[model samples]
Target: MPSSKKKSSAKKSATKPLLISAGAVLAAITLGIVSWQATAPAGTGSSGAPAVAGPRTDPAAELKALARRESGDKLAVGRADAPVVLIEYSDFKCGYCGKFARDTEPELVKKYVADGTLRIEWRNFPIFGTESEAAARAAWAAGQQDRFDAFHAAAYAAGSKEKGFAEHRLVELAREAGVPDLERFTADMAGGPAAAALKKDQEEGYRIGVTSTPSFLLNGRPIAGAQPLDTFTAAIARAKAEAAQR
Candidate 1:
């Protein structure tokens, strides 16, 4: 009878383990539901997260701060005096910008900037709010760590998903991009003139009448939206040709 009771106790223990597993699964699902509810973009439900506001029109201190905090001389992937400068004002949350980063820019870098015919300068226009600003700050901080290009590619590689651009996500993206000093990077994100630089980019974009993502300023010529490869090729060629003539 004692042995029978022992066997019964073992059976009960096995059932208890199963119950515990089921509870864990339920708990995970519940947590996921709560997190989803909290993070769902601005208007999914009455209880949805609040809307993310873009930059304000305050005296443009963010831009100035960014410039001051910027450690490098200039963010050119090629020669500064390259015949053509392709200034891209982009938002990380922009699909077209992501496509350009993934599809167009690689070939362009190889053909133009890498070969020294064009200089590519990226400006962050964080029109998407906290997440966007955080992403830009991560990139700037990564740049300080000498991994700007890597971080940029990582940020794009993280995909064009909108709300995933939060600070923690940016840090993860930076990690994927091979940023060595994660702690230092995080600290830099809060420090320096990051806010100012970001603000300035937005103000400058506003001043220049930029109303779209992935806008191109080819030697100061405005090209709205993402155009095909040939359009950029032609523009670069034209700029270089004109420069040569001068």
Candidate 2:
């Protein structure tokens, strides 16, 4: 009887340690679960957290979205059904573009576009970084107030005649060109139609491999560089010939 009692006491002592170890493991698990629940993001249906989404990996989709958002009531001047379309990819900060604005654009506008022989569309390709983009946006804002051509002429003239165009200088030009409300113009540039339109132009230019300013596209055929007047004349002639053939 004494031996049996001693054995039973030993068994009880062993069982106590096992029970303590199991309880400790269970307590640790409970604390871990509580901590996870406290720190997880809200709206997670489960007790634990959901994984976060990665960054957008499609560049083409992003550009398409930008183009869609930026093309706000974009206009087409000249005959609606004109056979030859002259798409001019111009940069506000580009010297060559300034030259064209001075010499080529007026001739083209007066001779071809105004005469209804060609459709002229201006796309702003602001490739000279932030300042170019800003200038283009400001011009777009000026357009909102029906002063685009005037603002464009002044800004390009400022770059050509006086000095390289600056942001402050463009603002001055806007004011001088009789933009009714300078403050509203500036604010529109900050966040309105102008910004969106410029972005659209930038995207279209990128997609079409326009890396430089004052490039022209006859229909969809690109004319690289700031080509001469003769080149433009030839292109116009070719476009007219093609239209006749079609």
Candidate 3:
């Protein structure tokens, strides 16, 4: 009886991370259709529309807790101790995600990330099937070579998503990003680390109730959709002020 109990505990311990990773990936690919409809109302839709900005419902503690603040994270930009962190849950296949990447993200990178006031950590929450997942993995692989931002720009370049993310296409994007080692890029994309990294981001997004692509958490208060620059700017300011108080 003790042996059986030990075996069950060992199994549970071994399976926990796999359960979170694979389960969340499967949910993003499958359950997302239903989950999005159910959970998206708190945030914006896929069209970059804003949710009703009523009184803030998310608690201050939770909002502040979302910042990873990891200096070594290649997928993130800005100082680790940046006063405000914007956690973005996005998919490569999402139109609004592309829109934000193109139009809004650059300005934020310039005004905030450059100044070391706001940190942006990307979450891979692919919801558009195999190709989207592939793109996410490719992006994560690019991060391994310290070219994630460059890869991000190329992947989200005007009309890039329309081209789709075949293995060759992803390789092409990696080249465009100047990833230095094409052979390594290809191998890394299919390797275990990329899958594990993608799974971790996806599970965190799901756990926090993100139901749509381009969903953002500015200090943990959910901002659904690809909101405008002003919306993000205001949220960043509030988060910074709140952080200062602490």
Candidate 4:
């Protein structure tokens, strides 16, 4: 006959391993859920960031106010009279900003800018540091010679930021972008006009609640990321429809 206490001991041992395995699985599942929630957009998460702003009451008026719409502005593209405007506040050193510039912006230019449906206004909101400020100034300097868009493309080319934007690198980029006068580019980058231009762009961004790089205003509606191409296409379509009714 078996001893009752010994049988009890065997039963407990059999269940102990099962209990440990179940606990581990439960812990792993809980951790996965936490990670998923953490990766959601900051404004939409429990991360304590400010919530995304709701739609504007007077989107068209606010949009018109921010559109600049200057034909001589080298940092802007498309027709000044385009029905939809996309104002981008970005940093030269931000990786995501580069992603949008390289991956998304050209597509927008091709589809909408070429057709006179959209205008893109670039705002120099340099949040990084001295290099960022310098790059912004340099881009503006390039614009003095009518090469701002080219310099912008070179600055945001893949692997460009890893090389850094020292004064010399900026000059090299200007050369690549075909600025007509290297002497003028250097002088303008260090001049007061560059500083003033940067200040104006930065102030505009800050006033409109832009606290991050690559933020955008599409006809006065805020889009806070380098979202998918469809996001932009949809925004442009909606803005165009609304403009037609105005």
Candidate 5:
């Protein structure tokens, strides 16, 4: 969804939709409607021509509650109390996700995260394969040592995914990220906590009907794919204004 040439990987979940409440059902329906527009090939509309922006929709309250604003969350950046929270459901093996990490995210961090205006939270929704799951676990393990950000940057660096995320490769990444305790890193990566954390993220993504990689929720407004920087900036501005009203 980043470009006409690039498309997101579809998640293969066998489970049915987990809409237990009216709010959850509405959230799912809202995402289902907007997701098509959000993932429409860049520069093209349903009629196969350049697309124009559509009227914005109200944020879904149920989705907004998905933001885990824990002050000590290691996989997040910026103040926990930031007015706008961008929750990203992404796979480590997703090329578009890497593009966002390399190109767009740093700018957002510089412009918004630095000022306590936006908080970006990471959700490891690994749908690619075993390697993706391994990488997610490894990332959670890195967070244990307060090195999640460094590890994330390293893992998403240019051409990093070309090398598969095998056990040895994960160890190499841990070293590159400067995780001080190699023995502990390996233990944590293979431990139960890492698996549980990965499951929690994956389940949340599935429940929200996130069918593709790099899906995002900006203050409860669904934004699919790796959209341009301006799209995110405008959404952040709107969310911030709405937060002020509340």
Candidate 6:
């Protein structure tokens, strides 16, 4: 009896760390969802109302480590070794995502990407439904030909989402984005690789509790919604300073 009791105690002790780790993950995800709900834009399908405030605190280290920083990442812009990285998880069908793409992204690219101070990595996080998933795959296919940015722009252009992301529409967008081989683009879009890539991105977003479109992580600091340009600039400045220190 004494030996059995000791073994039971040892087993409980062994499970404690695993339990703690799981709890931490849950807590982080809860915080991320709350933060996003707090700051998400009105009509963005997150809160369905105007944003009240921004993130309450910086994200956990586990969330920050989500940056891929891969040199050959086709869906990313700026130098691979840039001091700061901004990870954007967005749905192509999202209006606010389009707003960010059209209004704010260009400025960011011109200022930060051109200077090599920041890298922007895109993750396909379709939440609307099948069309959103198809659009995401098409974007990934466009990236195969080094045309992700162009495809993104064409897809997010005003009135583009209204046209819907049907197979024909996606192909048309690819043509507009200057994807060289329409045949190859179509094939790749329907291929396993695109699905795998989309799955990886979706899993990452869900793990970090991204319940809305256009959620961002700047050096692991969560910033929800399509906020003003100054919000991003300020965050970038702070992230840059921190990176310089590290």
Model 4 TM-score relative to the real fold: 0.76
lDDT of each: 0.68, 0.65, 0.81, 0.82, 0.84, 0.86
Give the top-scoring candidate (lDDT). Answer: 6
lDDT of 2 by residue, 125-198 (tens): 88877778877888777777777788878887744435555667777878877889988888888895676677
Candidate 6 wrong stretches, greater than 4 Å? 1-59
Q: Model 5 clash pairs?
A: none
lDDT of 4 by residue, 1-246 (tens): 469988877988876421123234333433433454445465652224564575324423544467888999988999999999999988989888898999889999999999999999999999999999999999999998989999999999999999999999999999999999999999999999999999999866664446677777788666766777898999999999999998
Give residue 200's error in model 3 in angstroms: 0.7
lDDT of 1 at 155: 74
User: Residue-wise lDDT of candidate 5 within 101-190, one digit each (tens)?
Assistant: 998899999999999999999999999999999999999999999999999999999999999899999999999999999899999999
* Pairs with backbone N, CA or C atoms under 3 Å apart (clashes), candidate 6: none
Model 5 steric clash total: 0
Ten-residue stretch with the least lDDT total in model 1? 60-69
Candidate 6, 1-246: lDDT as tens digits: 999999988988977421123344445676765566465565452314443364435445546667778999999999989988999999999998999999999999999999999999999999999999999999999999999999999999999999999999999999999999999999999999999999999977885677777888888777777877998999999989988888
> Which residue segments of model 1 deviate by more than 4 Å?
1-71, 158-163
> Candidate 5, after superposition: displacement of residue 218 in Å?
0.4
What TM-score does each of the candidates earn?
Answer: 0.68, 0.65, 0.76, 0.76, 0.78, 0.78
After TM-score superposition, what is the CA distance of residue 61 in candidate 6 from its true location, in Å?
1.8
C-alpha RMSD for every candidate: 19.2, 26.1, 16.1, 14.9, 12.7, 16.4
Candidate 1 lDDT? 0.68
lDDT of 1 by residue, 65-149 (tens): 1222222533447776677777778888877788778888889999987788987778888777777788887788887778888
Question: Candidate 2: misplaced stretches above 4 Å?
Answer: 1-76, 158-167
